[model samples]
Target chain A: MAKTVTQEFTKGLWEEIAPFRLVLGLCPVLGVTTTMENGIGMGLATTFVLVCSNILVSILRKFIPAKVRIACFIVIIATFVTVVELLMQAFAYPLFLKLGVFIPLIVVNCLVLGRAEAFAFKNKLIPSVADGLGMGVGFTLSLGALGAVREILGTGMFLGMSVFGASYEPFAFMVQAPGAFVCLGLMLCGMNIIGSK
Target chain B: MTELIKMVVVLVLLSSSSGGLLHWLKTQTSSKIEDQQVKFVKGPALKSIFEGSSNDPTADRFTLKVGETEKNFFVGKFDGKTNCVAFEGFGKGGYGGDIGLMIGVDIDNGSVLGAAVTTHSETPGLGAKAKEDPSFVSQLKGLSIESPILVTNDGGKINAMSGATITSRAVCNAANDAGKIYKEIKSQLTEKVKSF
Candidate 1:
């Protein structure tokens, strides 16, 4: 009845992708996708927290009592989030500044917690690691794609290079908060259409 | 009873280890984080205020104990003479919160050299103009540091930005605070500047 490790890992890439399939962790998805760089930076930070927390949770699952498992999971997650925050501040201060409060807010991202509770807590160590890595890569790709669309349409630039030339007036609306919602909705709709077929 | 004891024991071990690890990490990264803040946030503010100085003010700095906290003062060398210093001050009761101002004073003339906003959360287009637009702060360039700075509405010389009185007042307050610090440490500052 158990799935192979490869199956567990690959599922997160498409079948159970965090943002598109599970529709989770939308706060950062909407907030920091103003630029492609910011989106990628936020994605990598979340990925680090996810993988580390997953490993720790999986290792300790048998020892942690079910009655207080959520609380234990939180402590583990919070520790990793702070580690990500501090490391970013030290090495990538500019990105840290751009991400701002969202870094600390990673502690409450449901995707990290959901994985720990649903998959890591019940799975073997290698499978948990695979699942975490696959999910992380998928999330990074989704955010990068979203960020590219918003940046290009909103500013007529990609990674700060003028893409549409001087005459291409920026749409302006695509970078704003409302634009994030519409962009995400369209992306989700497109995903469903492809999935249905 | 045994199950309850196990839960408590597990929680205690996890919390303590987490706390200990975080404490160690904070200590390791605190200095690096400070360097980043100095480079990104305070560095530009100091550069603008110390414009035309022959030396890099950010690199030539000294710390002095003011009240209970230590404050870093950057020295600007103009014409091969170190006669100016820049430091930061906090203005209370801004529209959003306290505004941070970096004030540069010419010790030789006992007058303000320039001022720049280091950090603030004031409203954009109005209060934010304090940092974005240079005109508001340029007015303080030649004013004597000994006199109290105020907006025109407060029966003083400087004019407040229309629709941003709160933010304007905050900037003025921060200048006044820096002036007060300058006065209190005038001797020590002059002494330190001489070494540069």
Candidate 2:
């Protein structure tokens, strides 16, 4: 049974969310979510690359030899990542500075490669585009949510504004490395519970 | 044979086009990126060094060729006189790598105005103090540009940050280099400052 375009797109939002469900591309998912702003910036950059690579891969799927398909997909992804890096540096220097090395590292994001191989390589242009956009938006929302949780609990602040009053003591650990793991685990557990129901 | 040929052709075409596109984009954004770097990275140091200047030091700047390198010199107007110039110097032997120091000097008296670390990669809470803690750079104020700068360990007046002697030495080294550059271009700098 073949799925419709809407089904393909919606699946990424909850059923196959990259970080939580697919468990793909954990490096950036964990590394950049210390702050909501950084998380969103990184997610959007990745999204740009994902959408571009998917479109190109879908268009050239016929010509790409099976043996060298991965290599071609990487080249496409890398080109878009560089484009994002240059544009970000030119227009959003502060956010670019915060995101730093992760922008370049997006070229190696497993989610992008996985999508190229699994979906874009076999699908038509429109569905490939929808898949890319859905996955990208899903990744962005997950990072943003995770970052908000971490920022609120760790610093008693939301996007630099104090959420808890002056009396609230922040859980500094929530902003640290170990905190990322614990928080992710709990979120994953919660997601699973909701998913099962 | 066709399979190999197709793969090679596809790769070459993709790589070359990618290169061409990046090159063009880089050229287009190069100037904007430079402005951003100066605004964010070097802007703070220049602001502090030229705190009371009548004009914006970043906007009022000129570049001069010194030994095959074009170095930017920011002009600061004080009391309607533009006799102050600030420039950057790099110090080698830092813990992480070379450290960049922005030194401001008064052309008339040949005295130091202020100095700040523009870029550094030293350990946090230690060598990084050169950039973070103002007291270390404050000691460099008002010193004559003609003499070489050194830490107290080297029998000079400036004191090194505790447990960060290497970083402190690197900063002093940068100050000394800036002084050398200043003396070499003193006459040319005065001429340029008058035009500003």
Best by DockQ: 1
- Candidates' DockQ values? 0.82, 0.76
The 10-residue segment with the lowest total lDDT in model 1 chain A: A1-10
Q: Cα deviation in Å at residue B137, candidate 1?
A: 1.0
Computed on C-alpha atoms, the DockQ of candidate 1 is 0.82
Per-model interface RMSD values are: 0.5, 0.7
Q: In candidate 2, which residue ranges exceed 4 Å CA deviation?
A: none
Query: Model 1's CAPRI class?
Result: high
Taking the tens digit of each residue's C-alpha lDDT, what string does model 1 give over B1-196? Answer: 9999999999999999999999999999998998888888888988888888899887788899988899999999989998999999899979999999998999987899999999999999999999999999999999998789998989878899999999999999998998889889889989998999
Docking class of 2: medium
TM-score of chain A of 1: 0.98
